[model samples]
Target: MDELVERVDAEDRVLGVVSRRDAVREGWLHRIGVVVCRDGQGRYLVHRRAEHLSRFPGHHELAVGGAVGVGESYEGAAARELSEEMGVRATVCLRFTFLNRSGLSPHWLAVCDALLPEAVAPDPREVAWHGWLTEPELRQALGQKTFTPDSREVFDRYLASRAAPATVRNRCP
Candidate 1:
């Protein structure tokens, strides 16, 4: 079933609700929440998308996330995705938000952070495989392997936020 998601304007102001299919098909701006899960040791939980998945199948994702449901807050969606995809119930905080137009449609991606006390097995249906990669290792992997375009942008922006002089810092939807 297509999810119902909040459609937003350029500044992320809610315009109305729209089906996820329509949002993608029509290129409407919608909200997506992704959490950069980190272990106590600060390793990122990177996972490969299940081969059977329709979108970006067999590609690796650096975080766990999904669409922000209608009426759902970004943090709420991030937490929900973390639990649903990684089986970890952890507090997630919004790190930043940005418009990702690298993919088929534009989306306001809320990049959140969740420090996991420990690792947990991810849902096999969503994650084909997963591993914990350090910052340098992840950067290397991003160049060596195929990842979802949106994820690459997310990771790049995420890194830029910490190192660069400017970024999409603290933008919320």
Candidate 2:
């Protein structure tokens, strides 16, 4: 079954609704919500994409998520994805960090952050392997060609935010 997703513009204004396949094949700008999961120790939950995925198969992703459905808020999508892909509920608010664009994918990505207090149970269909990594470790891993393009962009932006000063980071919405 084709998943229904909201098509949007470069600025993320909704243009219409379309099938996920059409959104990709026709290069329609669509929204996807990503949740950056962190453990109590501040290690990030990184996972390898399932090999059977249609795009970026066997690549690493900094978060678990998917396209936002029609009439769904980014936060809602992020929460849903966190549950569906990782089987973990975020006890705190998933802060909307930033928007990332790869120019390689039609997805207008909304990145969020959540500190999960529960254990993760990655779904086999979306994640093949999972692990926790520190900032330096994630950056080093990103140097290799293992991460998906979109994921790389998202993680890079996230690391940049963390490195910025308190005031500077606060300026980001």
Candidate 3:
């Protein structure tokens, strides 16, 4: 099915909805929801994109995510994406990260961390392979450009959030 994506303005205000193909081709601003999953061992889950993907094929990503559908909430998208890509149920706690405009696609990226102890079963169509990485390993991988641009942004924001004081992180939006 042709996906219908929520379109936004340069400031990340919702304008309307458009076909995903047009959204990409026209550089339309949209919303991307990401879920960073971690196991009980504190290792982060990372996945390799399928070679047949339209964008960043075979690249590693730090989170399970996708473009927000036309009328879907960011929280809903995050949980849906986590389930679809990783085959895991997640209770998403979304935090608005930042608007990333670099590269071909521009999107308002919202990130959240999901704690799941069970092993992940990645979907073959979306994920080619998966691994668990320690923080040091992820930092090394970031230096090597192994992650997709969006994934890089997400990881950076995640790191920043971690470094933030607990009082600041817990304040209601």
Give the clashing residue pairs of candidate 3, or none. Answer: none
Off by over 4 Å in 2: 91-104, 163-173
Estimated TM-score for each candidate: 0.91, 0.87, 0.91
Query: Candidate 2: what lDDT?
Result: 0.79
**Residue-level lDDT for 125 in candidate 3:** 96
Model-by-model lDDT, in order?
A: 0.86, 0.79, 0.82
lDDT of 1 by residue, 53-90 (tens): 98789999887899999889999999998999888898
Model 3 CA deviation exceeding 4 Å by range: 170-173
Q: Which window of ten consecutive residues has the lowest lDDT sum in model 1?
A: 164-173
RMSD of each: 3.0, 2.7, 2.1
Which 10 consecutive positions of candidate 2 have the poorest summed lDDT?
91-100
Name the candidate, 1 or 3, with the larger lDDT value.
1
Clashing pairs in 1: none
